[model samples]
Target: MATELRTAAVAGSGAQARPVILVGFQAQGNLGLGYLSSTLRRAGYCVELLDIELPPDDIVAAIRRADPILVGFSLIFQFYIRRYGDLIRTLRAHGVDCHFTMGGHYPSLSSRQTLTTVPELDSVVRFEGEITLLEMVAALAEGRDWTGIPGLIHRRGGDIVANAARPLVEDLDSLPYPERSFAPEIVLGHKALPILASRGCARTCSFCSIHTFYRTAPGKVVRTRRPAEVVQEMQLLHRERGITIFLFQDDDFPLFGKKWRAWAHAFVDELHRSGLVGRMIWKISCRADAVDAELFVRMRDAGLYIVYMGLESGTEEGLVTLNKGITVAQNRLAVQTLKQLGIMFEFGFMLLDPSSTFESVHGNVAFLRDIVGDGSAAATFCKMLPYDGTPIKDALEQSGRLKGDVCAPDYDFLDPRLDAFYQALARIVDVTGWIHGHRALTPQLNWAWNELAVIRQLFPRLPDTDAYEAALRNLTRESNDLLFTVVENVATIFATGKGCEPDPQALRRQCDMALSRLLHERNAFMARHQTVLLRALQQAAA
Candidate 1:
């Protein structure tokens, strides 16, 4: 059940409290909304978060229970836009329309279209909404002109006007830490908290909308927190929430290019200075070009367990097509460096894109075999997905290769044969529910990763530490073997689909059998170790 709106004391005498409700899908924890809710509370506006993930009926029930004066939806993905529209209509039908606003990636780019389409949404807040939303809500509460406010789009007597883009928040440290404590129902078992050390990426990857999203605003593309502030926040979460693992949500966590070295050193220094080095473990994402072996070693010692690198393509031509700006050699070096340093890493590969061909696909498969190997590490590969306001999408539009609306474009390959293969592979994978589905390779990898984390918590005190470590190593290696075998078989089907009349039915059956075996083995391993693992954890804590 949704909680009732609690009142807060606003400025001035006898001011009637007007509560704010932030609505979003609970796919994962809405950290953006969490930050917004905290910021609102700091400014004295009563706020409640209504995150609906399950049945549609729950959404209406939550909205009715809150009965807020203002509702803000965090519109990040275009897929959810229709669902949000339905939600707004339901609220309006119930005669509950105080104010409706939305902000995030999708709305920031298509504000006019969103407002015009979803008539119930009164206004759309533009990029970096924390400050803009706080001010907008305050103005709306006191009957002030919000039109002058920068970073807002609203309807004005049959005219949709978008105010000037607001300057990027220079001092990110001034903002309140996101209120993660308020949304307890959605918290997962691991108690792994997601923290952002920085915002935005400096890369201009043609496939990404991040760079374009920030192009309108004036200032540096990437904004980072002072290292001390980040460590302090981590320490606080560690102490208060009993969270031992932190996941850095920065687009390019190691920061990018030559600038990251100094920042990394300072960050590691603070981790040690604050005594958080021994207590907490973290994971981050970065580009291949930005990795330095020595810097990574320091980070590993300071507790970085996993590093996710975007190795978008294996062939240089594919890399160039995506505008990744890094060579295949650079990616190899980064992967080799991590392997040498004994750091666990994963790769994000794009095997199929606008420029992918038979030769490139073969090269990508070979590359996967080399870097990823038969059974060692975890990696995920997929075709490039186009989004609104990205360079690739724009190019596709100009070339007439795109179908569907601007919100969600369906793209065709440059080569019809390649398109056919992709479609066939997609169908097979979807039907088998093994490759890219929720229970696919990535989730299995995540489960192994998380299980190891729990095991590591109890590593220091286990009576048979050496034997236990051996068992973990064996499990990890076997897990990777299963993942790689499944991936290779799937890749063969796609890589050969264009040239030969491969038996996709046979291939799909093979994949299903392999995945079923892997899941059964994994479940057995977990069941076998459950009692001992729990005991070890308890012993360590005691």
Candidate 2:
């Protein structure tokens, strides 16, 4: 099946190329491109997906070799404009140009502007692209005029034309499952794959663009798949590719609204009907208010292991500023609830957003303490970024506070002192926790927890695992406390070092020492059971 999908495609009248190309970032998964590929293949056109991270020379070489009828580029972020331009220039310079077009959240919302920026792109496919993209390929292959197609922007004659918008996919299950390599990503020893149960977010958070994106298109902003179909896809992947760790990549897993709850309940029922209780585990991201004890208990029994919430801020004022509908109490209650239910959880946090002050920063730290102080999960956060299409970005620009350009949009803090505090805190965390290239502390803890989850499921009688989990939690607690102290001390010093030690090198040394110790403890514990762990992962997928 895998081989057939990888090599399958029926040719069009004029697009009898070896492999039709679709380019995007594939660091972990690129399901957007996956859907486009599947949609085109369903209509009898071969598609190829290429990662944007590949060298320009290599990408050009692939296009030249395939000589595809149409090349689609997936641009998710506005900052990627310059990079895509450089790549397109290279492709054209190398004499490898066909029809160039792009689509994604950023491009979809700002189609004309993006066309102006990346002029080489012949057109832009706005909003959902499955139907639109297929329509485009058919038109291009049969030499049909495509300027009037909905959800497409392109040049006609001497002027750029903006066609009518296309309706969003109303029935998600009516579409085919996203095309995949079927070569699963490895999590500890278990094979993992990402799936989505729904599309679009219902919330209207100020900094978020997901709801805004869906709203611009014509249809129900939020749609879900049939529960039986979702379970059927999972069962198929599990049987065919040995994928046991299912990650639901829903913007908001349909667990909040009254109508959504019915869908959620049916999904749980389908999982039970398929008897997937003890054979697999899954993870999902959802809003905090949805973390109910009773409903989650049913989900937990049906193989739910971890839940991630967008606990963006812990202070009421910060939540207000960020336009998160829930209060600080709701966020705290959700975290506490998850812990009580014995479900592992992680969260998205922003210590500094568009609105920031010294007091708010301190309050955020206290909130972080409330959640991760007990070491139920590791602490991780960053300042909020004003991306291209978010509501906050428009607000910032209107208020004349938008700093930087389209590529790297930013804003000045209300107080310059807070700016200084932000820069200092960023350095500290960047060094000790969230380093991009390397395996940093926070991700280490996350992976360790995931590994522990897999182990507990595979070996319910595995002795000493509880002690290992406890030690891991204690280390996480310690790490969170130290970082909170460092953040507080740094902020206080920026506020004139009130009640803060002025030690500089010592703090850095302490961070290094703690990180080293963390690695040592985790490694020693795993090494002690290396032999057992070796077989654990093998049997997990087997």
Candidate 3:
């Protein structure tokens, strides 16, 4: 099948094209579907996307309107299984009876569970989905059996059968550019879009399934595109679509080790050579250990405005437990390096890891204080979930501490009080409601920082810009302190075994106050410069 796929495989040859409908989360550019869609279209098949966020009626109507031969669901997370199942069932009820398939880490890593849970799916396209999905669609169009294809799981004779998986695509550059025709992702009145310079991550963090997902197949765990090719794509997008903000959605941008470091340098050089160094800005997510002042400075010169690192834990024990293989000192150094570099940084943190005690929780909070206390970035966190294909999940299962089912998997801390503390904190975040979501202070500050990055790049000499940034940073610090104080208080009460009535109203009041001030400052800055900003943007678009 692999040989056949590599040889002569294109989905449709009919004079009237057959449309393959892809449905998935597209809030942040669903590159999974984007790539798949491009692959199908490149192979002479039509593809349409139905964003899952749309109302069910609209989704059903769109499917009906397209009348695609196959509907592929991008079930990226295990928790969304029920939601996808319900959606699939709804589709069936509406008499939309096209073939249905699902793909992603959850469906790939646990095919049996995925098939069993989402029984409505005709098959699961496991692992890297481009070739598998394309081949499946081709087989369906050509009236050939797709069940025997590589990288597929399907039901046969009331029993689930898993076929051999295809090796990961070794040459990422060979793949067509991802198809991105959705409504433009606008960031602060500037056009934004996601692009990829590489595919896959080499790290084996316990809570992350990326490494496992890549290693599940028999190929390179990571693959890179030529730097010139990446720059060419950026140039094309900037020229054709007027995209000024490029968000590299690679699992982690290739910037670690000798090979990846060279790739990063080549990328920077290409950015400069292609005349995009001063014309565009981009963001990337990377590991803390990958941060080097010199390399980041070069990247910043190449229009790198933001760096997001996953600093999973603070305590040495917590870091070791999570298999981070980096030190608290390294994390701090990375934060300070990027801070001094003046490149905005955000982070992913786990307030509660699988191994947690009251003392460690406090240590984590203190770490958050030191890193984000200055409000360079807003602070936010949640307890880590043992996802389907992570080492920590297996360990939790071995220790008999893993709770909940495969979907919505969770584990209680060894200390019951820590669990209580987590619940109280969750209640505060959920009820007071100004903490984690898009409209919350954390995300608000994140957006503000993004806008500031744009302004800093476009209008470098604008008057009072520095003051606005300083004001935003102060608001961020206050917001971070408010969050830290609330969490610490809850932790202390829970640790000392004190009966306490947690009042989220206080949290609500503080958050509301902070948010009001943030909005006022942000609005004032915008009002002061909207005319110039608008003119600059309009000319750029022109």
Candidate 4:
């Protein structure tokens, strides 16, 4: 049911005309937009990528000048949905009647909801957008009815209609490397080298949103670009775009087991063969089980500078509860391997799972202390949240333990209680790092502490470090001050339960103030420490 538009020659020239404009996140450093722009250009569309981070007026002016027949917006983060809607409204107010289409994680999961919210959106691409969007542009260019295009959702009269979801692309190598040339020089700036070597993850972590997308299709239909193709793209980015830092934005780079090893070997061989082995430095996300000393050495030799691993929990039970499919042992080994290889790494840890108890929380701290000994390891911790469509949310909902609606903004991955704890721990960790004179951990720790203080002020009765154990006594006093406020507020609420009428708005305001403080403090910390953190990271790698 898919149709390809025939190329048309211009009146004055023999060359064929390409679709004039394509808007995407050229400035946001997102891989989805890069893929879309590249695929569209390969399909013979003249693409102009727009950065979502730019001002609304600037975006509007660019769109007006381009006067594109097709305006494609790549939606990656749910946080930007409202902002995108505002921009669309602006475009409409300016009498720009271009066909608006959206693609990305949010649209892929909740197509109907997205269409309902952004009624101005002419269509939404449900899943893997490269081919779907390419086929759509062809149909639109040929003036053909697009009702038959798979993975498309359109508004029909008063109803929203979705075509069948498209099949996953099996041979990922067939797709052309994402076109970076379409991105504006200013938009790319100095740090814009995002690449993807593989697609889909094998692990079924209960709290992750990745499953929501992969579940659309059956089985482990993971695909990877050939090693030569991956290396070629890197060379092109370096030679043409002046890009040096290549980040492999895959969920799990080594999903195909030993297949990744083969690819890594081949990739290194290809880089050496092409004489561009040292032209760029690269980073990739991988499971703890995927890396080893040998593999790290190979990757580092081939310009792989950083490896990001998700060490979700420190306990076996926590790992099982989250269905991470890996153990704490593997996580430790992975970190050790990276360190031994002299390759930089970033460790991801998640605290505050539904099953997490005080024991598990303490275990996490112990595990961190052991692994991050003397500030030699680089790691970051985040609080767990039950994202929509994840098994964790489903299990919690089924067990009747998950309170409130999952769609509520307040129910984000980092709930207030856990958020405060993580913030405090992060600050303690940062301050500890600073005391040790490990500059790399200072910014991260300062940011974490400021955030903890803000969240503590906002949510009065949350527990603090002193209440937990003596090991974290360094932060005990600060924790007591934060926890006392929480206890006092709880006392007030309980005392008013019988005959005293309490204003709900007052309680809500207190909660809102806490959240605002957390946000403000976190931002201030980042503003103060971003440059220092970047410098430390750079120097550590050097």
Candidate 5:
């Protein structure tokens, strides 16, 4: 099946040309690679995907088998660059002479430094990669001059040559759907899938990198695929891949407001016509301002099971400082609407920022507690880090909030002072205990419900009920272990002098004990609610 899929992918007039191999999520699972692969394929390049998280030998074997003339790595996080370096070194050790390259958020912002570190990399495709990579590969494959490619950084003799930046794809509708055929099949258990409907953000939030990278383009150029095209792809997935739960990977899926509603209705109508309306559930990201009661109802009716939102800060000052461009009232309204619609969601919170004080942090915590209702939602809160090319980093550099050159990828998220603040802040939020208590238990509850639904679907015949129940029971125990591990780690971090303390050893042990107890209580709560939670999930599935 894999071979046939690959053959069909390259069976075109352009199949005679040398293939371009694209590596994605070398160590972590991310969405950028999918976009790159889709764009490359659309531009008439045969592409191969390699997930470096697989065994080193497997990656080497795949590279050897594909024998591509050019390779491109898509990086979303800085830590993954080191993994790419390892792959590059391994390739060299095996005498593979393919030209190496990369482009994504990190490289787009810090192109010069990235080019220097991995000189083995022949070039770096900067900014929007679809046009840049397509141009680069065509030039190389056809043995033509490469100087005209706008978004390329290459070495000319001993000097690094950077061409003019390419403008963002103004009409995103022109791009092809992401080549999901290139996605590596990893064990995501219940088949969680990520999909993107659009690119670029409309807001210029201070701590975000999306606006800075896309700021070259005018306001929100929020382009989207036609509703028919999106529905066509969803139908294809349903028929071909058994994907029933899609997690929209768009930064802001509903950025166009009313336009999104129209698209949603069209999408649902299409699904209903195609007989796939009730076959799958989906989720998407939305801004607080984009969501309201009417929109939530439309979304829920269209089979949206979840809607992730960036409720970044709670305090008015924190919101203003982050330039979130939305008020707390709007945030509350959005959350309430989602809850009223019976849609589940995960709200991301940026816990500690530059302007954060004890009072502000407490206020943020209060806001989180109120919304999360004791952290029941599949929500996450973390300290803010300055991604390169964000307005916050630029502002911090100008105001001396950040020291030294910002080009290096070694910016630590846990500076001593920041760590201390987070440590204190976590106390207010109780995130450590929350994570320890809830992380493991919730998935088990979810799995239990899913198994029961599957049984009911296949009832009377009853295929391996004992096996399914055993799996759920084992998963619940495994979840408990994972929670305890988190509790231990958080406690150690808080207790150790290396993390955020003066008394060091004594403080560490004390914090560990306190956190352990907190987690234990949380575990007890999960245990008590496990049956009710599973039943609710079963009911939802029904």
Candidate 6:
């Protein structure tokens, strides 16, 4: 699949020759690699952007076909570290001698460990990869010393040398827009482009690695693109690609407070002046406390449809423990304001963490219910996974709660009963229609929502009054219903003891049956809706 995708991308780009190939893996488009590709190509280097979601053999085949000098993997998560390591080995075994390098969150945090463990990786670019990668590519091409390059870790002799970190790009407007043209298929929902209006974040959440990654450098933690510059990219994407949906991939969008009020007003004003706001809808993420009702109203009037907030926890204690710097009241107010303004919003919640107890878990459950109510599954909760460079992980390690190495860590519950209940809940959720093993439910739902959003955008283009939109919404409600049912069952076990049910296996079987029924219903719904949507699209086009 990856090979085919790469070939299609190359053909689309009208490139007749092999080029330097950069690999990236993500559920969404790889914006980091996109930025790198754009920079390198603008410097006159041929670059091919390949997503590593394809099978290993396909990846090897694609790289072999390219026969490029360098192959860099953007390592965003530790989960894929081992997988990419094996891939590098396979590529080497196939006599592909391309210099393999990796960069992103995991590599930036554990460059030495990554290089030590993954011997096949020639180097690891730390932090923001654009400048470092460009310099490395130049050095590799000209046979120059890449060791002096900042923000790089390269194996030298018997040891790995970690270089100094590169300074953050202060003038974000100086950088060109990411190269989406190399892989246009990566565009979400046909025309929805994932764009970053800013980099880094404002707040330092204990559980997040963003601040840690940025902390490696000196100076301002967050950087912004000029409002005019951002608007210019929107206009360009709209004019060139007919894109109508702009998903701002900013860490803290609108910077929603007094500190960035001038920037915010300028951005909103630019959106209005550019006339791009009239033609496109946008989605963004921001802190719960950062949002302002008045500013959001203006934004909504400028085609803002969705807002994603990191609610993280429901209890004030949980928020404090995570060092989220926002109160529970603030979270409530934010949700209420968005709701009052008729803006569609989604949130993230960490249900279980190192400090989780039965009481806290119960509070979280109640909080989630209070916010979204019963049968609202769009907002999903997750167990906090400790990534490298997070304060939470450091605290867990210091307290000896972590059970594994830095690459992969595990934590035990303070309460054995709560642990048992969590295990059971995970087992049921893994087996249910809601989630697959280890993968979070939110990403799955987000993927589904993106697909549906694309279809919804097309629905209005349909001349006939079709029921597909209703079907899609009904499917979402039904999915959420199943999620809430599972949540209630899990809550019951948490309330009572682990032995609350006389037969635990019976409860598991019931959950399984319910999930099976839901999956069957969902399949039928998709079939019905797809037929209606396809017919409508065809008719509208005619």
Q: Which candidate is the best by TM-score?
A: 3
In the order shown, the candidates' Cα RMSDs to the true structure are 4.7, 3.5, 1.8, 10.7, 8.0, 6.2
Q: List the residue pairs that clash in candidate 3.
A: none
> Which of candidates 5 and 6 is the stronger one according to TM-score?
6
The TM-score of candidate 3 is: 0.97
* lDDT score, candidate 5, position 321: 82
lDDT of 5 by residue, 201-263 (tens): 777888877767777533345666666777777777766766666767777884456677787
Residue-wise C-alpha lDDT for candidate 2, range 294-387, written one tens digit per residue: 8898888888999999999988888988888999989988988888888899899999987888888899999999889988888888889888
Q: Per-residue lDDT for 1-542 in model 6, tens only?
A: 22322332333343324467888774567788888888677666799877788888998998998898689998877878888889899999999996889988889888888988799888998887777777777766766777888878888888888788877767776565888743343323345678888898878899999989898776577888888898899889878777777888888885666757678878889998997765677889999887788888888888777889999998878898889999988998998888788676778889888888777877887777667663222557788888888999889888878887655677877877777777777776665434443234434444545544444444544432234434434555555555655665676767674534234455446545544544464456566556666665455334
Model 3: per-residue Cα lDDT over 485-508, one tens digit each: 888888889988775746888878
In candidate 2 the C-alpha lDDT for residue 511 amounts to 58
lDDT tens readout by residue for model 4, 1-542:
12221221111122124354555556536567666766666555677777777788998998887777688888766666777888898999998897899987777887887887788899998777777777777666777877788889898888888788887766777666665543432211233467888888766788887867877754354666788888888778767666656767888885336767887777778888977665556668888888867767776787776677788898998899889888899888888887687665667777557776545766776677656643443334556666555778777777666665424422322234444444444454343332224243323433344233222221223333223222222232332233233323333333344233234345345434443544455465445555654564354234
* CA shift of 276, model 1, Å: 1.9
Better of 2 and 5 by lDDT: 2
Error of 4 at 508 (Å): 27
Best first by TM-score, ranked: 3, 2, 1, 6, 5, 4
Candidate 4 runs further than 4 Å off:
1-24, 181-192, 218-220, 399-542
TM-score of 4: 0.72
- Candidate 6's TM-score reads 0.84
> Who is ahead in TM-score, 3 or 4?
3
What are the lDDT scores of the predictions, listed in order? 0.73, 0.82, 0.86, 0.63, 0.64, 0.73
- Top candidate, metric lDDT: 3
Candidate 5: minimum summed lDDT over ten consecutive residues — where? Answer: 182-191
Please give each candidate's TM-score: 0.88, 0.94, 0.97, 0.72, 0.75, 0.84
Residue pairs in candidate 4 whose N, alpha carbon or C atoms collide under 3 angstroms: 38-179, 385-413, 430-445, 458-514, 460-485, 460-486, 461-486
Write down the TM-score for model 1: 0.88
